[model samples]
Target: MRARFVSATPSEPAPPPRDGRQSAAALLVARGTRRLLRRLDFASVTELPLLSGRRADIVALSAGAELLIVEVKSSVADYRADHKWRDYRAHCDQLYFAVPASMPLDIMPQDAGLIVADAYGAAILREAPRHKVAPATRRAVVTRFAQAAAHRLHALSDPDAAGAEAF
Candidate 1:
């Protein structure tokens, strides 16, 4: 069966807090992280599906074509319960965990980068170590990113038309 994709757009009303999936706090961290990425000259898409069948919390593309994935951890329990964040490393050049300031910094892995964020903004506390992606993988990732962005934009511009297509 084909999958149906529904992403938020400026014209649509905000989904209920958490949208029955993400917690409000986690969503806030993602919001601030996206802002921070924009400031850093990176364009990002939230909840992007990776080739490995794992969905990333945020996938950002730098001007130099570097890919970074940010996993949002709202609380200690949230971080501990998740084991799939490590799998994200294969899909991007760098991996990071973004949390609110209230989260203790030390609990996060020392290897990946870190960011502390809130609803308004965010700060990168540590830079992630880069593991360059293969050229073929980079091309595939960039293509996916562009396609996702374009699909969302099309949905916003013409909801009926976009919905009619097989996504």
Candidate 2:
């Protein structure tokens, strides 16, 4: 995804559009993930680029340096269309599927963790089994996440820096 700066004032600027504005359900999932992860003391970055050329909906890092990736499915159609979610597991210690409470959880892959979310909050219905990532892989993911966050923050001030791609 590409971002363009739209400055409303010389001293203040709006954040770049995120994935060109997420779908309603996706927005809820993101907000809920933030809320939940915060309680667990996990810092998260959204729309994280992965090694497989796919973007994780949310990538979180815990105090112990454990990595978790969550893929948000907004609807039945969204869930059905994706087959690449498995690719996310290779990049993180644990993987999860996050969806609105109304979504049919039964259809989600049993091996992945499950999160039932609303616009306000989320609850982990199942814990994902950890498959520890190699140290080299962990370093790569952490570097990507850090660079993405830094670039976005820099864009907020220098706007022109928004052109730097995270991947």
- Top lDDT: which candidate number? 1
Candidate 1, superposed: residue stretches over 4 Å from native: 1-19, 162-167
Overall local distance difference test of candidate 2: 0.84
TM-scores, all models, native as reference: 0.86, 0.85
- The residue-by-residue lDDT of candidate 2 on 4-120, one tens digit each, is 665558666343347664787788777887789889899888888887788888999988889999998899998998888998988999999999988988999999999998878
Tens digits of per-residue lDDT for model 1 on 1-167? 99777766658643312225698899899999999999999999887778898888999999899999999999999999998999998889999999999999999999999999998899999999999988988898899999877876676546688352322
Determine the C-alpha RMSD for candidate 2 after optimal superposition of all C-alphas.
Answer: 5.5
Which ten residues in a row are the worst by lDDT in model 2? 12-21
User: After best superposition, candidate 2 residue 103: deviation in angstroms?
Assistant: 0.5
